[model samples]
Target chain A: MVQLTTDNSYGTWRFCAWNGMIFMGVFIVFWGIMGHNVPPYGGDMDASVIANYFRDNANLVRLGMAISMTFAVSYAVWGISIGKVMDYILGRDHILTNLQVWGAGLTVVPILVSSSFWLTGSYRPEALPDEILQLLYDMAWLLIDLAYSVTSVQMIALGVGCLRDKRAQPFFPKWVCWYSIWVGFMFVAEILMPMFKSGAFARQGILNFWIEFMIFFIYAPIITFYQLKAIKRIEAGEPAA
Target chain B: MSDEQSALQQSGRAPGDPGVWFFIIADMAMFAIFFLIFMAGRHEAPELYRASQAHLDSRFGLANTLILLTSGACMAKAVMMARAGDVAITLRYLLLTLGIGLLFGVSKVMEYGTKFAAGIAINTNEFFGYYFAFTGIHFLHWIIGCGVLTVLIRRVRRSGVNAENINWIESGGIYWHMVDLLWVMLFAMIYLLPPGGTA
Candidate 1:
């Protein structure tokens, strides 16, 4: 309930914007830190080419530190803005407890699965018997696909929430709401794309780089910046109604 | 459109949920890509991978898994307690979640610490590299979840936790559960398969 957001003057979402700018700073620093032996950014090498590089990066902590801190601090403010949006159209009746439980259950399980995935993602295929190699490949592949599928649902709900809420007019941007919905819809692409894993465009690791790079370099920062402006505006003055 | 869709469009409440989910999607996307990278990378060095993986310690992974399992339960209980409208009990469960979560962190730090001391730097090769990078990232998340719960507990005490405002707690719980879920995969990938240190 910060009535003090508008005070940032530069904008309500200033902090988030500032955070993004700084994060990009760190990301840029990534190149300098990773001098000389570069991963095949533009073209050919297998994706392992990149993984091994990061696998050998001086310290995982340094880069990770930059990502986690930026998001944590930025989201702290971001969450407040979300709370405000929720208050705007307070629901007539709380969502049924069952639905809430389902949501909570669905949400919780993925966290556990991902955590386990953390330890497991690193296993080298050579260690396992060469005999069952294909089986291992298939299993791991299927598991990841399943995990990604389930987790994507969480994002869909989020997108729906943004799309449905209109009072967010002054605070939340139309782009954010719509983009969220769009992203939710796009996750389906993963399922469909993999079905015909033979498609060169879909299989080529390069495509992932181009699309993901855009999200990181362009969309995330812009959206985060806008979010920061909204928060600052609400935090500085005239508590958001 | 259905009545539900029409009502949601008119009333801001339906769409007004905070941007946490949106932010979470971004984070999850990053993880997904890295995961894909890891899998594809391992596919290349199956021999070195299997050999290196055989050398890893599953016991630690299992123990860590147990700790996180308990923490997830604590997180769920914290939400239920807070919803029950008893400040004292809610605070207790929140504290429980925090303490258990911190223990998970400590265990991970110790796990990594022991590994490092034993000369298993991330770059020891792709196998060890992935070991550190993946688990290392998970460790980072556990720390964040702990910090979140710590702050949340303080907030619950200062401002009562009622149905109107309980989403905050639920959100944190959702995040903590994610931290736990990731561990399950981590164990299977890093410890169960390839035989990290075994023949």
Candidate 2:
């Protein structure tokens, strides 16, 4: 077994952290403060009234496309940044395991199903002939979407198991394991949205969005703050591992 | 041989060097926020949800999944190498890890670039919009992971720090795995929404 010890990396790590924060802070401020960032507060898909509005505007349509790509990249980078910071707090060395890779991945299906459901919730087939309705869903799209939702939920459960397996990986914290278990169930709850009568739960899910927001947007950043404080301890001549 | 032996020794990972816990917590938040946004958006649309997924490319999902799995394995081996405390071997694995990360990153750039070129942009549909966004985020992380690996390799060679510290290697490995795992979701959600012709 190889034993490892920590020493100052010629202060480069500190400089890197400081500089990274500064750059990221500036961009985050612009994205948030300047843009009045509304992060997916659920859209009105049922509003043909609203759809008709966007179905016409030229600039709004183009801007929408531009904004989408920007958000995509944003999510990607932010995800990474968050992951790195969390690892820092945990005092762990093993970062990625097969389990985590799969957990991060398998949850995508349910997530997509959830996102798609939110985006197009307003779609109400106007008295389709049974044949057409059959053909419509039978086109294999709805089934896959449904499967994605269901499978995604299953993946979440599997992810929790994966993350919790200390034997597989020693780096995951106890709080994180429990946190994942709790969080995983939330995604599982999402599957029930489709089963609700007339997407009623879909709307309810929006109402419940704050619960998620509190955990992710609010609680998560708070945890990061704590992690940073712990890192400060390490900097102040404390042992992390 | 003595100089090489000295160079091959790892130092500086006692208690101050970074570790995997930070990255794991980071993974938690990243996925947490992602799930939050996805849930928020999903609650907004249910009908287009099904059809949009049905249009995905399972082949792409499987291929990328394989790529990521291979990368994850390479990274895990790198961690194992670091634990062995052989600077040269650890550096070799780090380089290989970088290569795999680059491969994944380049493939993503190609795929997303193709979409951009084809005029079928990210937001072509609500699902596609989110699809590209999530994966795009993962891609950026992949690039960062490669950068981290590169730095570790150089540090080990230049007599800078502990290349054999399990914490450092594991931290990087965890972060990379997070990226890899995110891709798994991206593949399933964005590409393989339909399996065996039944969406």
Candidate 3:
């Protein structure tokens, strides 16, 4: 049985991790109801089409964006919890742990920035030209979808660190490690998205948007589930192995 | 067979850890999504898909399928031989499996080369986009599986066949079978299917 030598108890941050899940649920519901979710106004719709959509749902969209911004804060809390766990496992501050922390911090940027774009577009749909509205919409999607490197790096760092836990009962199960690596690699597909206006690689296409989104949604919950379990066992003073 | 071997055989259990199974299930789910999306694309443009598929070399696809199947058979044999306590024969079968797996990789690279030479790319069309995306991802899996196999070979050589090592070897075999099974589905969808008709 491997014992953690750190003085820090992971309990407080574990609660924060659980709260992150709640924030995720809030973001999903608010975004789905108000932000129009992905493929806003249907994936392939033109600038005029999207502009009209914002015109109709401006109030709801703005409210949704405002609420969704909170999701970034939730993510930050979750990321810190993850970094703490990683540090605990390694018994010291390490390069990969730092990378994971930095990556987590950077991930909040896209969500916050992108949601702002959506908010700006919805704030005055009547005053803004269709082209400008479309530009904002495009920028929002590009940041959220194409700027995936930070998240990918975070996953890789966490995954690699988890795989290093060689105890009989590892801090993370091996499957989670492999899952992180595979899903992280999948983010590379986003690079092709900007080139295609249609097809599976398009911004709203099946491979790029739907598949990627579903994977991320499931990935987070799974990690959180395992994390909670690990914390419970740790609190019980069970051997890590 | 030794009494110990017989006792172990009677204990019915799946090879490898439950973690690998979890990984496999999740991977299959992801692939299922890709399949569904591909089907949807076909429904939208039957003619384009059919035309694009026609350009693919079915012969090459068939050859690759055969190689993978044969490799799977060799892997199965290697597991059996290892269980029977015949380390040398197990090594032989494993080597054969690795050889055939590499052959499949080579064929895939050649196929991509031919496509590139003819100016076909992911951006060519909807059909081609699915083609490259699906195959490209599958190819990456193949590379990883090969790496797993190589590691298994090294471990077996260093530690010799034993209870613990056998479990690790079996896990590697399971991963290889997954790669093979995925390729079979891909070959049918990308090569054998008449595009307009569902596979």
Candidate 4:
């Protein structure tokens, strides 16, 4: 049996771990539903049509994107907590731990910036030209999709760290670790987002939006479940075996 | 018997890590989405799909399929050799598998070059989009599979195969087989299936 280290900040760890769930909930409701991005405007949608959408639903888009942007950092907070736990498992100052934390922190940047772009478009839809509105929308999608590698880095680090835990019982199950890596690898498909306008690889297409985004949404709660459980075990000073 | 064999006895006849099956299953599901979407698109525009698919040269597809199946055979043989504690033969078999797999890559690149020469590209149409994206993603898997084979070869060379190291070889073989299986499916769906024919 491997010895589990006692940590003084277990309470904080619990809080940060729970924040992942909260982030998922808030992001789904605010950013996805209220922001009218449940399916998102299509890449092939006309510029004037997009402009009209913002012009018609300005307040909702504004409020939704604003709130979603604020809660986006909760993901970062949850990541930091996961990083601390990984540091405990992998050892202090491990390169993977650093990569995990850094990746998590950087993951917030694209989310924040993209959401702000949408919010800006809705800030005063009437003042911006139709093409400019479409430009902002396009830019947001590119930033969000292309910047996926940062999150991939975070996921791979965590997955590798947990997989390497040679304890009788790893912090995460082997299936979860492999699934995390799979999800990270799946992000490679997002590279097609820039190339397609109206197919399964498009921003609003089935493969890109439905499969990619849903997998990401599903990954959050799964990791949070394991993170909460691991934190609980550590809090009780239980042996890993 | 080695520890891996003993463990295999205990866990039944499952090869490699059972956990790898999860990755394999997930990958299958992902490709299922791609296939489903392709089918859906075909249904939407049957004539266009028929025309575009007609442009594909089945010879290249057939060659690649044969290449992968041959490599998969080599990989299986290598795993058998490793299990038999024949490290030298295992290394040789791995190298052979690597060479065969590289032929698939070369064949695919030449096919793509022919397409480019004829002014057909991924963005040319909906059919081409599906064509490129599906095969392109599978191409990535092939590349990764090649990398895995290289690692296995190096490991066998450096450390030799034993009970502890056998799992790595088994797992790598399983992954390589999956790459082959996926390409086989891709070839059947993209090359063999008539545009209007449902499989």
Candidate with the greatest lDDT versus the true structure: 4
Off by over 4 Å in 2: A1-241, B1-23, B29-47, B54-56, B160-164, B195-199
Model 3 residue runs over 4 Å out of place are: A1-5, A9-11, A30-32, A87-90, A94-103, A123-128, A156-182, A185-192, A199-201, A239-241, B1-9, B43-45, B81-96, B196-199
Indicate the worst ten consecutive residues by lDDT in candidate 3 chain A: A1-10
lDDT for A8 (candidate 3):
48
Candidate 4 C-alpha error for residue A21, in Å: 1.1
DockQ, model 3, C-alpha based = 0.38
| Residue range A1-241, candidate 4, lDDT tens digits | 3333455588899899988898999889998898888898999999998999889999999999999888999999999888767765777667887888888899999999999999999999999999999999999889999999999999988887878877778888889988988898899999988999898899998889999999999998999998988888777775444
The candidate scoring highest on DockQ is: 4
Kindly report the root-mean-square deviation of model 1 from the true structure over all alpha carbons: 16.8
lDDT of 4: 0.89
**What TM-score would chain A of each candidate receive against the reference chain A?**
0.48, 0.45, 0.92, 0.95
Give each model's whole-structure lDDT. 0.52, 0.47, 0.81, 0.89
TM-score for chain A as predicted in candidate 4 = 0.95
TM-score of each: 0.51, 0.44, 0.83, 0.95
TM-score of chain B of each: 0.83, 0.75, 0.93, 0.93
- The order of the candidates by lDDT, greatest first, is 4, 3, 1, 2
DockQ values for all predictions?
0.02, 0.02, 0.38, 0.81
Q: For all candidates, what are the clash counts? A: 67, 56, 1, 0
Sort by DockQ, best first. Answer: 4, 3, 2, 1
Candidate 3 Cα deviation (angstroms), residue A12: 2.5
Which is the better candidate, 1 or 3, if ranked by DockQ? 3
